[model samples]
Target: MSNCCSSSSCETTHPKKHRCPANGSEYSEVSARTIAHHIRDALRWRPTANRYFFCDDPACDVVYFGDDGSTILKSQLRTRVGVKELSNDELLCYCFGITRGDFIANPANRDFVMAQTKARLCSCDTSNPSGRCCLKDFAKPEM
Candidate 1:
C-alpha cells in the first residue's frame, strides 16, 4: 500500500509498456499492489507477474492492463473508478472519502485534503484505483 515504486514488482528499470486495448491509449504503469487492492477478490487471481498499467480513459471499461496482454475491467474492481464514473457523486479523494459533488459543494474540502495530504495522512496508493495522488483530480471551484 506504500509507494509502488518501492516494490520490486513496480520497479520499471526496463518496463514493458502496453496500450489499453479498449481505447488504444498509452498505459500508465501501476503496481500489482494497486491492482490487488482495487480488483475484486474473485478476480485477484487474474493478474500475472507482468507489470500493470492503468487506463484513465473515461470512455473505456478497462481499468488495468498487463504487459502480458491481460486486462481487468472496471466491472471487476471492488470500488467505482471516479474518473470513469459519470456521476458527480463519484469519489475524487479516496483517502478522505471526498466525492466530486462534495468538492463542488465546498471547495474547502480540497484544502482539507491538501492539509491531510501534507500531514502524510493520505493513502492514495491502496484506496485510489490509479494508485496516484488525488490532488490533481480535484475540480477547481468556479470563481
Candidate 2:
C-alpha cells in the first residue's frame, strides 16, 4: 500500500486504512480490477500500485480513495454508484441491470437476483462500486 501522501491534494490522515477523504466514513476495500471497471476511461490510468477503498456514503463525493490519500470522485465513475443516488432509477443489481424502481415494483426481482447469485451468475465484485453482493442492498426494499 502506497502511504506516501506527497501531493497537495492528498486529504486523508496517513496510516488510516479505508476512510473516505470527503466524509471520514469507514470505507470498504476494493480491488484494482473493480476500480478499473467502475472508473471512467480518462481516470483508468489513475489507479496506482496502491490500496483502494470504496466510499458508499451517499453524501460523499469521493467514491474511491487510496491509502496514499489519492481519490476518485463519484463523477469520475462510468456508472452511477447506486448507494449514492437518490433517484428510484438508481441501479441496484449491476449483474442483472435491475434498478431500484424495478426492485420496488417487483419483489420477484430480488428473488431472481438471488437465484442468479446462487447459480453463480452474478458479478458484483467487478460491477458494483461496493464490490459486495447486491442482496445486502435488498434488505429493505422499500423505496
| Candidate 1 global Cα RMSD | 6.1
Candidate 1 residues lying further than 4 Å off, grouped into runs, are 1-17, 42-46, 139-143
Q: What does candidate 2's lDDT look like per residue over 1-143, in tens digits?
A: 26556666566654335777788878667888888887889453666647888887777888888887899998888889998887888988999999888988887899999999999999999888778898988766445
Q: Compared to the true structure, candidate 1 yields what TM-score?
A: 0.82
Candidate 2 — which residues are off by over 4 angstroms?
1-17, 42-44
lDDT of every predicted structure (CA atoms):
0.83, 0.81
Can you write out model 1's per-residue Cα lDDT over 1-143, one digit (the tens) per residue?
55877777984567546788778889778899888888788553766747889987778989998887788998888889997786888999999898998887888899999999999999998889898889878853331
lDDT of 2: 0.81
Each model's backbone clash number: 0, 0
